[model samples]
Structures are given as C-alpha cells and as structure tokens.
Target chain A: MSDKKKTGADILLDTIYKNGVDKMFGLPGGAIIPIMDAVKDHPIDFILTRHEQGASHMADGYARATGKPGVILITSGPGATNTLTGIMTAQMDSVPMVIISGQQATSNLGLDTFQEADISGMSYPIVKHSYLITDPKEIPKAINEAFFIASTGRPGPVILDIPKDVANAVIDEDYDDTIDLPGYLAKPELDIDKIKDAAQMISQAQKPIFLVGHGAIISGADKILKTIVEDMNIPITNSLLGKGCFPEEHPLNLGMPGMHGTAYANMALCECDLVVSIGSRWDDRIAASPKEFCAQAKKIHIDIDLVEINKVVKVDIGLVGDAKDVLEKLHKYLEPNDTSKWIKTVNKFRKDYPLKYKKEGKLRAQHVIEEMYNLAGSDVIYTTDVGQHQMWAAQFIKINSPRNWISSGGAGTMGFGFPSAIGAQMACPDRKVVTIVGDGSFQMTLSELSTAVVNKLPIKILLLNNRYLGMVRQWQNLFYENRLTGVDLEGNPDFLKLASAYGAKGFRIRRSSDVRKVLKEALQYNAGPCLIDAVVEQHDNVFPMVPSGANLDKMILGFPQKRKELE
Target chain B: MNNNIEKHSISLYVNNKPGVLIRTSLVFARRGYNIDSLVVSNDSNNPKFSRMNIEATGDTDTLHLMLAQLNRLVDVIHARDLSGEDILQKELSLVKLECPIEKRTELLQIAEAFSAKTIDLTENTITFQIAGSSEKLNRAETLLHGYKIKEIVRTGKVLMTRGEEATA
Candidate 1:
C-alpha cells in the first residue's frame, strides 16, 4: 500500500479486507465504477448479484448465520434505494450489516446528476449510523467506524456513502486502529444489584417461566440461559427468532409463543406469576395485546439496548446490558426451586392442547414440515420467508444450536428466504442450509437463483406452493368475513421449470408420502442449489392460532369443524 | 403529570459537522416531540463543537427515551435535559406595530413598562425590541394586540444553569 498510490476506492476495499472480510455481495453500476475497477487490484472476491436487494438480504443471512457484520457494496440512486428493505429487516431483527453505496461526485451532488442520491439521508432512520464522505482521507476512518458501530451494541445496519470522486481521488491513507466514536455505547456495564433483585424475585416466585429471544443468541448466552432456567426450575418458551436459544426437544421447553405459538407456551407465559425475559423484546406478535401479555407476571427485562426496557411493556427490574454478562453474574446467586405444582399445570396445558394438524386427510404444510424435519439432518440451518410456511417451519422445525435458525421476525419480509439462504450457505459452506419459502414469498427474490447457480452454492429451498398468500388469506377468512381480495396467486409460475431454467435441481412433493423421499433427494443433492416445491393443501390454516388482539388462553386450536370451546 | 405539558429544555453539545442538526431533529420528531423553539450556534469555548438549545413539549417517558437515542448519535457529544434544575433563561423578541400618530407615545409607554427599547421608528410605525423569558414576550405581544402589529418574531428560549455545572 505504501509503494502503490492507493485511490479512495483502494483504501475503502483495503479497509474492508483488513477488517477480515474475504467476500462481499453487490452489483456494479455507473456510480460505483471506480470501486469496481479497484476490485481487480484487491484480493477481495465480490459476488455479482442480479439486484441490490439480493445483495443486502444475502448479507443479512450471512450476518445472522455468522456473528459478524455482513458487508454489501452497491451503486447510488436505485441500487442504494433497493437495499432499504433488507436494511430495515436486519435492523428490526438486530442483525449486524454494513452497506457501502457509491454516491455521485462531490461537485455534482445537488445538481441531480446521473445516479445521484442522498442515500445516507434516506437510510437515517433504518441504520445505526451513516457517513457521507467528502474527502478520500475520511474513507478509512468512516469504514472502520461503520464496522465497529454495526457490530456493537444491539447490532444493526450502517451505511457508508462514498461519492465517485472520493473513490477516484488518490490519497496516502491507511487503515487506522483508533476508533473515534465517543457517542456510541457499545457495551453497558452489568448492574449487580439489579441481578440480585431479579434472582430474589425468581427465588420467591411460585410460578415462573423463562422467555428468551434473539438477544440470547446474539449475546452467546445459550448455555448460561439453560443453566439459569434449570437452576430456577422454570418452564422456558421462545419467540419466533428465539428458537435455538433453548433446545426445542428439551423436557422443560414450551416451544414458541404468540399469534401462531404453541398452546402450552402461550398459557405458561400468560399464567405465570414471574416472567424472566432475557434478550427478547416485547414484540407485538407475542400475544393478543401488549396490555394483556404476561399481565400477571412480575416481569424482569434484561437486554443490551436501553430503549427496549420500557418500550412496549413495563418491567419491575430492567437490566440494560448484555444477556451473557447479566446471566454470568446471576449464576453466582442461584438455587433450585420447588416447581412440582406449576410444572403439573404447564404439563396439563401441553397435554390438552398440543400443536395438531390433519395428518391423514391431505398433504398439509404441517405434514411437509414434519417430514422435512424428520428427513433433513438435525444440524441444518433453516431460513424462512414471511408467511404461513414460515410459521409452520417455526412450529415444526426444532433447532438445537445458536445461529442455525434465521428468519425475518420483526419485519415479516417476504422474498427473504432464498437470498438469505445463499448468504448463510456461503458463510457456513460446510453446513446444510435450507429456506422454507411460500409460493408468494419465494417469487419476490427468486431471481437470485441465478446468483446461487453461478456461485455454485449448495442451498436447498423448500417451496410450499400453496397458491395463495396463506397468512393474509387466513386473516381474511377469520377477521374479514372471508372477503379475500389480493391474496390469490392464480397464475403462479411453475417453480420446477423455473429451477431447471436456472440450471438448478428441482423436485416436487406430490403428497405426504412423497415428502420424505423428495426432501431426502433435495437435501442429499450437493452439487449445487435444489428447489423442492411441496404443493400443500390450499385452505389449510396453521392452527394453535390466537386471533389478533385475543388473550393467550383464547386460542382456536383447530378449524371450525373440530374446534374446542375455551373455558 | 403537570410537568409533562410544560416545555422541557434539552441542551446538546454536538460536533460542528454537517447533518448534526437534521440528525438531532430526526430523533425528536421520531419520538413525536414538537420543537417549540431551537437555537443552534458554534460553541464559544471550542470551535469543534456546537451548542444546541431546544425546547419542546411531550410525554416525560418518551422524552427520556428520545434523549438516550439523541445522545447516541455519532456527532452528538452530549445531550441532557435541564428542565428540573435552577436556571437563568431568556429570549429576545422584535415587534413592529402599525402605529397611528397618537398611538406611538402610548406604545412607547407600554414598551418602557416591559423594559423594551425602541430599536426602530418611522412616521407611520414603531418597532420595539424586548428581552426576557417566553412569558414576558407573550405579555408584551398581548399589550399591543388591539393595535395593528405588522410583524413579530421571537428567538425561542435559551438557558444555562446557575451553578458551575455543564448543561450538556
């Protein structure tokens, strides 16, 4: 770097390479020509994506799978604007990511020049931080700060807008070790007194439940969280993204809770006298209403973000710090509790209203998930799109390790599964990566299959082609008096042919009996990407459904023909 | 509850960099806080930092949350709410009135009562400059309400604690 005159582009790419990033995802355009030109000089390999949105989502999937900030590069204007959804999705889920977009030259910034945009301005609300570099010398520090800011605290996306002129400007800049960010609070100190108070409360409580979420995984507190739960003899329930924090197969696990949650977990959360939420925010989908969510529990909210403390629901003790840090101190003052009676009640709920579906009637999504889960290896990483299939996957698939379950939980974004699966597959090339996608959700970013085929990523896609936007259809069927409009996908493309056209393997699960066979073929096909289109029942809704704004106990366990009235 | 409606003063010490003002305003706007008045200028002590004095009305809980978010901004050095502390506050207001021949003397008397100075005078109009709290400016404007007040502008409130302690 000293011998060669490095331009701003070289410095930017060098800084990224110095940060330990070997590969990045993006598409090249006019605004980013300088950066693209410098790419040949650097050792970094760039994955050419069909669209910038795919680049962002792929980066997101990579970030979630590996606990590092996923890096993305793109041009300005439409290219930068296209990454907003991915940025918002990652931000909502607290995934760490960095997006570098090329801006118009500094001289032609406000004249509405070609590919000119105020990207950092547009991304202000979605990103953790943003920088619009006017000087080439600022590139090194801006990049370093971006990576640091994106990966620290409650990890989120950050944007670095480098003008084309800045990228082409020759500068004698080098990556610096010092980070000049005084305002950012990356790590908050653990309050020992608050931990003690929370432990004391847990000890005195007769009925307690451990509600864990994505934060536990982010903080790497799974082992300690399990230790705390077992020591306190509490039943544990996870949120949608909370899977893999506590093993779903564990005897004390109550599975996921909320709108499409398991009956027992929701009941346990609703009836418990004490609720210990570690890392999980009080997301709206958790229950019928925030007012009634864990209304009886003397709640203890432990998280890394301070704003999430009294954000939605109030808590008695709010410990604003990392989950692992608080749990480490909390481990010092723990003893077993006599949970004979509460366990009996939790077991009764689990036994009486277990998650059920019509196994013998038709090829339901539940059956497909069941067969796929049974067939696929237990160590597979599952990323899902937003819809009924995502919910069914959450209910059926049981993850036992952290970072194995990736989904668009908060944003509920469709078209996330395929590209994200590509990212996850690239991140963990050794592990099996599968995306449970719906027909509606899969088509949104299905163009990325070309990226997968070209890159030769061995990603398996489980496409549940139900011919409808099933989640919205269910809402319309239940809430809007069956006046379904805009939920039907009548003229959907043949996914099998589409897969073949992209030079990827394709299979179809014709019925419940064929699920295991087709999934086994897809899962075992390791040459490149494979798509398994399981055309499930058209009107089959995911059960254990808590109607929006309804209390947890008031669940519709089955369809109307087999419905059981709640007491 | 009574204190919730009253305008809360937030003082921020931020890097004198571009987009700092927009970033600070974005935090307040997201928390649904309306900025009644704001004054931002270069910090006298250090040219590298800027001082922003903002007064707004909103719920106390959201205000605290917004402050935390604002303080976390990369350019914001420090942000603090000084509404509960004992402080000296002031504002300057300029009022131009369409004065009749006889009303000029009467308007001067009203201005004198409020310790106002006649900064401008013409055959048909007079303009008064007054300095005090927002309430005093409001009273001065009300005293000349019946007359045709041509223009009125007030520098939103600014404050500093009485003790030798930093506001931000």
Candidate 2:
C-alpha cells in the first residue's frame, strides 16, 4: 500500500500472494535466482519439482482439484520449452494456471546469450495470454492481469516472462490492484430467449437426454444439473472430463458415451430424439464422426465459449453463456413430464449389455479398479494417465462428487497422473489421492517420485504392470492384422525397487486374491507416498469400442469380430 | 478431404506489440497453408492497434478452422473474411525488365498501355511501378513476362470496406 522503493521480484510475489496463491511448483535456475531469493522472504510455500513438465502438470492438477489458479515458476530456454506439453494439456482441458518464466537480461537478449529464448513468442499459441515485462514499474500490473485472464471465463494457462535485470531493478511506485484490459471479455450474459427455446424443444421431444460436460464442474452447476435431470425424468450421460459432475450411482445417470463408452450410453444417444449438451465441446472422441453422431436427435449445445458452438457439429439451438446461468433460466420455463417409457427402454439396454470382463485366471485391471472403488468409497480423489489404464479407471471407478476425478481428457498426455496426484494431495491434505498409471506411461515422468517424497505427500500410486502399450497393441490386433511393433516392454524396471530408491513404500500383487489386500495396505500406509504394482493381463482390450470413423451403433462388444468385414 | 484449393483473404485487427505479427502468422504456417501475400501497418487513428491483411490458399474446411483459431488468439480483437465482403483491394508492384537500346521504345509503349510509370531507368534496364487491383497487376506482369525480367518487388494487398461499417 505504501509507495516505497521495491524490487520487481518483490512486487511480483506480493501480487501473486494478494491473489490468493499460497503454493508454487517449479525449479530454480540461473536467470531466476533473484526471484528464488525473494521467495525466501515471502509466505508462499514453494514446492521444487524435479522437472519443469512435472511442475506444469502439478499446477494443472492443483487447479482442477481446488478450483483455484495454479502457479508455476521456471527459468529460461530449455526450462520454458520443457513446459510446452504440460501447458498444452492445461489449455486443452481448460485448467487455470499462471506460469512465470525467467529470461536473460534485456541487454543480453537477441545476442545468442546463455539460456535465452523467446518464451513469450513460443508460448503464444498454447497460452490464453502472455506478457513480456521489460520495465520494473510494469511488474505488478502484469502479474495481476495474468491471474485475471487465467482464472476468468473459459479458464486456461497464462504466461509472464521477466528478464533478469527487470527483476533486480528497483522502482518507487504503488501496486495497482485495478485491472484494465479492454480486449479481454470473460463471461457473457445469458440470452433468455435461447433458453426458452431449448426448454420448449425438450418438452416437445419424445425422448430427451442431458449430455453434461466439464463446464458444469467449472461453473459449479451440479445442483442445477441434478434438478433438471430429476424434474424432467431424463437420462443423463457425462463426457470423460465430466465424470464426477453427476453421481454415477444414480438411477437416472447413464455412463459416458462415444468410443470406449458403455453400450447403453451410446445406444441411448443414438436413439434419443433430443440431445441437450451443456458445457461440453463436441470433441472428436465424443462425437466420433460429427455428421452422423446423433443423426436422429435434435441437438442443443450450451457453452461459455462462443467459438465452440458450431465448430464441430451444427446444433439446432446454441446458447452462449455460463452453464449454470443457462440451466437456471431453462428450469424456470420447464414442466415436469413423464418419460417412463423412454427410461424403461434405456434401462433394458443397460441390463442386456452391461460392462463386463472375463474373471477366470490372471488379474485384470478392471477388477483392481472395482476393488479400489469399493474400498475407497466416495471420499477419494482419483487421477489417471493416458492409455488402457485411464479408460479402465473411467469405466469402473465410481466418483460421487465433482472435482474428484481428474485426467488429461482432451490432450491424453501419458505422464500426467503422478505429478497431478501430488498436486491434488497438496490441495486437499486430508483427502486420499490415488493415481493409476500403466507401465508404459509411468516411465515417462517417474522422476516426480522425489517431489512426493521430499514434500511427504501421501499419494498412492497404482501401476498396472501390463508390460505393453495396451491400447496401441489392441489397435494393432484389431486393425493392423495383429502385427505388433515396438509395443513390448520386455525389460521394464521393477517398480517396487524404483519406489524403494525414492524412500517410499512399495507393494506388488500377482493374483486376484491379493488385489484387495495390497490396495488396502497401500491406502492405509500414511507415512508417505506408496506405490502398488499390480501385474495384470497383457492382451485384454477395452470393450464396447466404436471403431474409428464408425457411428455409435457400430460398436465391437466384448471382442473382435470373427469375420474380416462388418456384419 | 476437400481437395479444391482456392485463395482466401482474411483481415485482422490486433494489438500492436513486438511479437504479435509472428504469433498471428504462425497460425497459418502451422496448418500448412502458404500465405501468398501479407500486409501489416499501424492504424492511423489508434496507434496502439494494427491492421493485417493476409492472402492464403486453402480448402474450405481447413480455412474455416483456421479462421476460428485466428479469432482465438489473445492479441486479435477482430477477424473477418474480407474476400466475400464488399471491399476494395489493391497491390503495388515495381518490375525491372532487361531493355536493350532497340527495345527501349517498345517497352515504354507497353508500360504506357498498362498505365505504369517509369520509376527507375538505366542504360539497359527500366523499373516500372504499377498500382492496381491484384488481377490488374497480374495481367501487367503477364504482359511483361515475354521480355527478360530482372527483378520484381511487390507490396501485398490492403483492403477497406466500401460503406461506413468499420472492419473492427
């Protein structure tokens, strides 16, 4: 509040602190030494990650878990580039993050100096916004604006690049708390007419389904969404990122739809007369082939971003506003209807072809996930890496609340689970955080085990040791005449021994009987992080998959077809 | 899988920053679309903003996706397809052709027919400057292509709407 001479680094830290950021994840480097030194004087808790990519994913996981903006700090050059994958992951999933990267001195820039790169230019496409601060006086305003842009509307990551000299320079100026961004528009008001039209369409349709997405969680519209589903007696399904928005145990809730989704959910989408999508972009995974995704349905799309309305599939009615606002308004104009016949049909479909797997010999990944769901109940936060393990977790794990299921849905990044679990654990110190990763995905960013050990984060790691890239192997088996290449991991390291090297607890289970016992032991081991490696079946493929370029009705259930052509 | 490629002219109004130009153009280059001509200049009324006109060749679906991506850029305030709008487009080009003593009179007559001005004249070369629509400039260049052309410099197209409805 006082106009005293302060260093730019101090102003930047003060601004972040004032914006309600208590923890930061990153590493220290040469150009960012001043900022690291200033961190000692501040009250923020800095978690030093082993790699910059790990730091970015940790921030993303923290944001998804707590509904707050995650902050990250890194040095110049390679440090900045290493965070690209993580930044793109956050941008794809709409997570809010503030990334501060240090740069070389202003005089040393453009001279091919040591560890100098155009961080702002490189990150422009991936970030929501970026700022390069050259003046000491502009430090506070830049930090404030970066946080505002990151956490508002369709939230995403933002970057602030500061030169070494700018951080060291002293300026006599007061911190400006007011944000003056003429170009940035966060939330748009709801159009009542569009909501009314959507309500009318839903009432007139014979069978209507509510397609919810991550936007519901972002807008905190779980209550309104539940009300709409219950009042109208409509069946509801969620996207991969929207797993926990609605309770999976509810009778009115169908599972996810599209590739790797349940047969009942995809059938319901194909048969419904109206598909009311809220806060979910019609991604390729969700819509498969957009032209024929729901040919029989009259679609209504609601989202906060105006550009995503008709980008994929054209909708009959498009409402550009917050999910909560639009749902609340639509509820006012809707009336209770009897959808008993439609619900009965959907129930029959669900009962006829339920999600099942063979349970005879070796341990299956689905069985382990089901056991974890039963033991952990509804109070745990779960994260998963890409590939077969992620799909298994999504299909079997039961999430009872919003913000409890976190994954890299859109980008499908492999090394996202472990560091993200650490972040989620940090955000909710009392809740149990479990990360399920496959053998191939776990090795990508295994160095983050040190971060958990150093911070004493009690995150449980579930490694599905299948010894192969399970998803790609399945694709090769089905589409490429079973000629697998480079999918085997024959000489993989022992995960239990790896955990021991990081000074943590490790366990292994090779039989179905030992699954529950080992999982219980890992969850109860509260001293530090625990790694439970479960050796599961190798050639098992996810069921009820709609092949590429196929419609929802053309699903391969249980196993591959007997003939070479379609039936 | 639409293979019919056609030229597209897109205009954007963006914040005038040091790296905004590269950021704006990268969107096109990443999509594998070749930008034939790109013109950028600061807005006279508002010095803080700049207007950019880019001409690229792409298919219909890819161009639509590119426009959506361009509008999502942080520095861009507004983007529009000026090719379909009622607008005026012009390009300026300076062409240097090899001219011998016997062919100097013939080259001057050709330049006079196309309303080109002789900007630079040497003993064996003449640089004629022409300003007109893109089609007109292409026609003039085609007429001078038979002669041995030494060099050519072109200022890309700039466009403005006909009525008072501002592009931004």
- Candidate 1 wrong stretches, greater than 4 Å: A174-177, A561-567, B1-4
- Writing each residue's lDDT as its tens digit, candidate 2 over A1-567 gives 345467888888989999999999999899999899889978999999999999999999999999999999999999999999999999999999999999999999888899999988778778888899888888888888889889988999999999999999886666565776765678888888888998999988889998889998998989998888888999999999988898988998887888998899999999999998989998888797888989899999999887788878889999988899889999999987779999999999999989999776889999998898889887899999999999989889877799999999999999999989989999999998999999999898889999999889899899999999999998888888889999999999988999999998999989999988998888899899999999999999998888887888888887744746534
- Model 1 Cα lDDT, one tens digit per residue, A40-97: 8679889899989999999999999999889999999999999999999999999999
Question: What TM-score does chain A reach in every model?
Answer: 0.97, 0.98
By lDDT, the best candidate is 2
The docking category that best describes candidate 2 is acceptable
Per-residue lDDT for B1-168 in model 2, tens only?
A: 466688888999988888788777888888777889999999999999999999998887677777877777768887888767678888999999999889999999989988999999999999999999989999999999989899999999998888878875
- DockQ for every prediction shown: 0.67, 0.42
Best by DockQ: 1
Worst 10 residues of 2 chain A by lDDT: A558-567
Please give each candidate's TM-score: 0.97, 0.95
Best by TM-score: 1
lDDT of 1 at A77: 96
